[model samples]
Target: MSIAGVLILPQVIQRGDPGEVVHFFGIPIVLASYTSSVIPMIVVVWVQGHVERWLKRTLAASIENFTTPFLILLILPSATLMTIGPVTMAFSAGISGGVEWIFEASPWVAGAVMGGLWQVFVMFGLHWGLIPIMINDVATLGYSVMKAPVVASVIAQGAAALAVFFRLRRDHKIKQAALPSGIASLLAGITEPAVYGVNLPLKRPFIIACLSGAVGGAVTASGGSAADNLANPSLLSISAYLNHGNFVVFCLGVLISFLLAFFGTLFFGIPRSAREEEQPQELSEDLDSGIPAQPVPADKKVVDADAQVVPAGVVVPVAVDEGNTTDLVAAASGHAVPLSEIEDPVFSSGAMGQGLGIRPATGADGSSDAESPTGAHPGRIVAPISGKLTAAMNSGHAYGVRADTGVEVLVHVGIDTVQLDGREFTPHVTKGDTVTAGQVLVDVDLPTVTEAGYDPTVITIITNSDHFSTIEPRTGIDLAAGDLTVVVER
Candidate 1:
């Protein structure tokens, strides 16, 4: 249908009315003028999925094969022409008219509003509402101006992620995570990973990206650019703009948005404190010695507390004795809660492993502190046990630490936070890095978690429970970071 509309239909229309009726097998068939449209085809195809299932259930195998094809090829198309086709066409026309009115009223204002709020809509899942309008615009008007500005928003997000990746160049773990996410957004028009993982956590980059996207959107709208199809707005989909004369303007808009966001974030998005905190440390000649020098085996003898200093202001109450019990500290200060009270099934059921959940404390007024520029609920996930960081999610929502004595702990922040990607979390240490008791693992934004409709309860579990003789929990108590929360006995 698309090929015929673009190639053969124009010639056919030049000769005679494309909608003229013709007799076939003594039956009148009214030829559709807008046969190349998208909505009617989509509606027909959607109805076909349901129709095929009903046909299979009602017909016998011997007769079904022949009858099904007849119904699908003849009856279905006729029914679509008589019913679904006209209805969808009318619907598309209405939506196109409405959007055209909005754009015609004030192009630049419309562009700025749409581009700036597009990502916000995505965060709350409201962007799905715009999909139909975009599809309708192409079907009714043969092109859509709405999506041209959206391309700017998508590219800006990717540029912001790249800026963060460069800013944290020394942190291999963060670089590993940010680079791929950035590329995905820039090339594929998928911005969730970049928005939630890299930009939102930092705050400044996300704001700058939105502003830059607005500028690009205004420029594209002022140039009267429109996309020829409903394809996602990404670099790879630039071909959609070729049908219109504004391809160059679209390309220029995308470039401007990307560069503006990249430079804006690189200069001002990352905080000075974060830079100071993440500065590279001098490495010893023998890298194998590791941070907080490897402890002597329990069989060798007990290690003194003074000799083993905790990192990042974490306090270890007991001396290191490998054969003896190990204390797992509370990663954040909060009201202690039972795992059963958590909203998520995986954590509440204790199926992920035996653990305790903490409902993190908010501001002094018991309200969220998310309005602060740095974010609300400023707290760090401290190292629960003196061990090597074995696994850490790039999303910053989860971490796995393995003690020298073989006790493995999984500290997961927020129930279902993985959905947010990495919006409100920041990792201080990467996987495989040796960490001491009280070392800051990740910093979390609790208010952002709550505002996103997720429970801000952090769960700490002993993943390798079989190796321990007993796993004890300090429940029903308000605890601070590095406070004894669990005891793992080998």
Candidate 2:
């Protein structure tokens, strides 16, 4: 019975009007298959990363990194297929069974309660639970009371996107994207594209949308209208709802939801302050602290300019050379390789940056001095690829770089490296200094440090490692002063 219910939605939408059609575009192919599921999630993760970068640019601080987006995608799809999908089926069957009992005894009361609770499920991401009953009711019973309220929820969210169209004025780019997505969602059933993309961040509009969705859902429930199939809650599937004479009531519900969310947003909110407005506050604080805001070359933007150190995990090392204007000159000239090819495996999987890793630290021999192993260990850590140096500075404990491709690479040698306390090191560039590929970032006294029993193994990793798709290493024992170590791809 549950399986039958789950299949009900697609059957109705596909069978509804002889003229109804499906279109394949972008990542979400309309074909009914599991294979089609993977790409959309990847696209979602990509957008999430883009949003993270955008936040860094506008706010001058990062809210989160790309890892947050990658994890969200990684978890959502598997759960959707393995857990949420099946659980939804069972949940729908249970609800339908309970509703049937109530309707057999008192139809009107059952209708009222179902209507009220429908939107509640959506707020919790549990509406999938109702899909099966809605579909089965349509196919087996030739109609359903389960699907209609859900459609109303879709309308509510779309209306909320429209709210963003008016509410977010400070950032024109977001507004431009939201307007079209908002309208499309109203006419189609997909809300996540807009929810995660635009509405959620625009703030108050999402809240207004949820409230309106609840109202619209209640209206659909009261009418006892049923959707014929799931069809991903899109407008193209609206033919199923057309079967009922209460189409006018459904339209009315949609209208009310839209108006309520839209007007509520306009009357109650104000535009966010301009970016310029916040800078002086930051600068003022910096001045009061006796530290001034230094101007970095416009090319190298910091990824986590203000992020606290992430709790310790595997601390990877990334080396940075200063730009040519300073000390970082290219060992050799070459066109830019795609960023993904040069990134490490752990970083590539996370879409970070391009760079190379050396398995054996230079001084494996026991005879080497405790601090300085001149053979290749400290100096052995060279630039992964050639590019205009983005940054070169000692962050009190470690040396870091911002590459021309806008990647931030940090190189920390040895464990508890920060404990080196800015001793036994030569810092080549000051803050805001430019460097080139393979330029010496720091001159480490390896033998002296090793004599003190510190492992001079250097860690090189892309700080913004999540921006890449893949990074491959070059096949050679020794890389030229400016030879490529990592190859990157978008």
Candidate 3:
């Protein structure tokens, strides 16, 4: 799709008026514009995938790479320009026209339906059909009723997140995540974080917000409000969209959506299990006990899972044997937690791949001041799986290990502890080092890090998380310095 999109985009006709699109082969071949389209590209890509696979199997290997791309580029552009592109564009335009018809019949009903399910449409790639309608409405009628209800849905989600923020205590990590995610949606009109991280997780908030959005959309459309511009549905961009008649109605509807979702979540409350889960709790007793992190003496021996007593200095082979699943161990001895509790959006949002957080902190203050019980120093961060140290930061705050099975793992000690300038961190390994699971990679002075005002949660992430079918973080349970914490499947 990457290579094909670039090749096909430049040649797609920009002709909007029916008369301007001259017929191909003297037949009325409608060349629909592909600006901001989804369905067409999806269709093309689907076809291209099959086409590329067939090409690879049939073509001679000597010319396979060159011929495959060459053939795909040649076949897709013409098929798209003539058939698939026109048909999908027509289908999208047809959906748009049908929506316009509904608005014409009863704007209120149209608004209610679109507003309630706009997010669903966005999720399923079905909303691409509406883009042309909105563009056409603005150009021909100077306003787009189809565009009016969008903000209602957006605002509702934002309001729900805001409600979650208010519902959780100040010390709760979800509360912290909800606040920024809500602001991003309510102000900036970006709701992916809010929807995925906050609202959807709670379940009820999402349903409530959608219903509230319906009411808001109904009000906006019933009052004959329309959008004159195509822009993100956000508070900052609302002014540009409110130029049509009954603009006050649009604002009023938006306000209603916000208030409704907010109140609905507040009054209804989240699940009992959620409430209980949100309560402040400490990690395992092993971590709470003030055990110092200690390195094994060269003469000492640690027994492997296979029961082989290997000497401390003899680096065990980086473990890479696997089948359907790859299990990662706890790199830090503390309370195992979901990435969502890590206080870092990059980790919590599942954007950096699925992983877990080991909170060494005794309380919800999010400082990992505790290491573990074994009387061994808790500051030691070990390799969870046997892998080559692909990235060993000199600062000793982060390490990226690549398992021979092609799994990339990142072990980051503490949140924002890098600001401490490596003053309290000691690196035991460097880049390109092969390490066994349970081998100490870095030893940090947890107390010094916590006193320096940094979170001491040890974060472990699979950098290539998306490559697998599923990456499950088995958290919220007791784990030792090297216990199974995450499971990734292919």
Candidate 4:
């Protein structure tokens, strides 16, 4: 026999970070380079999960909140001759080159402007615009003098976050998470947690942070020292400052920035907890008109026994009682819960029906039957839509339904709206009562709501609107009753 030929495999070796080495299949590998892109999203994910409730409300508000600013941003040119890449390169070279020139001519002014203006950019969430320049400086020039300002700026941001820790009288959990994140950013440059969680919550703290960042950046600029590499702004990388032979200057600059932000936040004032706290208020005149809001179970039955039935094509004209025919009376009048409180993305989007979203009768995670009970058990439960009671849930335990075509929909307002025991509501119809569109279902006291920190995001889900081929929502942008959602063939 020729005998089987035996071969030994060659080990392929790779490089890694500081003295850390590993053997993969007998191949020694070293990890040297780490990219920020490789940065784990865990921190962001953790922050969001912990503050899911606040974030959900913020997201809802953000959707319509940025309308004006978003519109303006849209009007700007989409294309620019000077691409961000080129602009960044030029800007970096200019800032660095210019600073060098300034240092030679008059370092004081240069420091002040750099320190102050850098903070201004950060306040608008525009700091990401400079990342390319920092990366390029390290790649092409072996160092990045442009990063000094940001290191200082982070210190300022941290200070602002700290202010919230002391000033907040409520929501201790939010403050606890924010304070550490802020301190972490000051020491390590991870500002997202601070920005999103704390400083931004208090308007004045945000402003104070910017001012402090600027002051700190100015000090760094005056030191005539610079960073040796473009690296993530974290305490782990402070050694980069040592390359400039002025580690002391860098430390001082960071310290000054923090003090300025902290003291400035204290002096300028962090908004009182009351300012950020949610309060319920009465609905304004804006809440009136268009969608005639009627309480459910209005007397005899939701459908009028003798009411005129129009043909498919004929318009079902709704008679208006200007006195009580306010379309879309505030849905969650005095007990609106944040849309995010539901946790179901589908429910939060309100895509299910007008504003009605189906969620856990209990809180997210199904904590307990007690803490999260909707009073109605799981599966196809009907709830009170507004404050007004039609017939006291005539079945003794449950109320009647709002059915159109072959479908039925359950209506409920607020989280524990029924708990109000119909305090702020007026019942228009009673059990087994017939009701026409535009009928006054209930009267809501909106003012009493905002003062209580309720969002009043009314929900009108089609609990059983599906039995019909399709229930088309009525025209007009306002999402209220009487807008005419047609039930037709799919």
Top TM-score prediction, candidate number: 1
* Model 2 global lDDT (CA atoms, 0 to 1): 0.52
Off by over 4 Å in 4: 1-110, 117-129, 171-173, 272-490
Model 1 lDDT, full chain set: 0.77
TM-score, cand. 4 vs. native: 0.40
Candidate 1 residue pairs in backbone clash? 314-438
Indicate which candidate wins on lDDT.
3
lDDT of 4 by residue, 175-243 (tens): 787679877886777787887777766667776776776777667766665677766665677778887
Which segments of model 2 are wrong by more than 4 Å? 1-95, 100-125, 231-236, 269-490
Error of 1 at 250 (Å): 4.8
lDDT of 1 by residue, 19-128 (tens): 66655467765555554456666677788778878998999999998897677765665566555655776777877887888777877777777777889889998888
Candidate lDDT values, in order: 0.77, 0.52, 0.79, 0.50
Each candidate's TM vs. the true structure? 0.48, 0.40, 0.48, 0.40
Q: After superposition, how far is residue 347 of candidate 2 from its true place, in Å?
A: 18
Residue 271, candidate 2: alpha-carbon lDDT: 54
Lowest lDDT 10-residue stretch of candidate 4: 1-10
> Across residues 179-230, which tens digit of lDDT does each residue of candidate 2 receive?
7777777777767756667766766666666666667666655555666555
Q: Which stretches of candidate 3 lie over 4 Å from their true place?
A: 1-42, 73-75, 119-144, 167-171, 270-490
Clashes of each: 1, 68, 9, 54
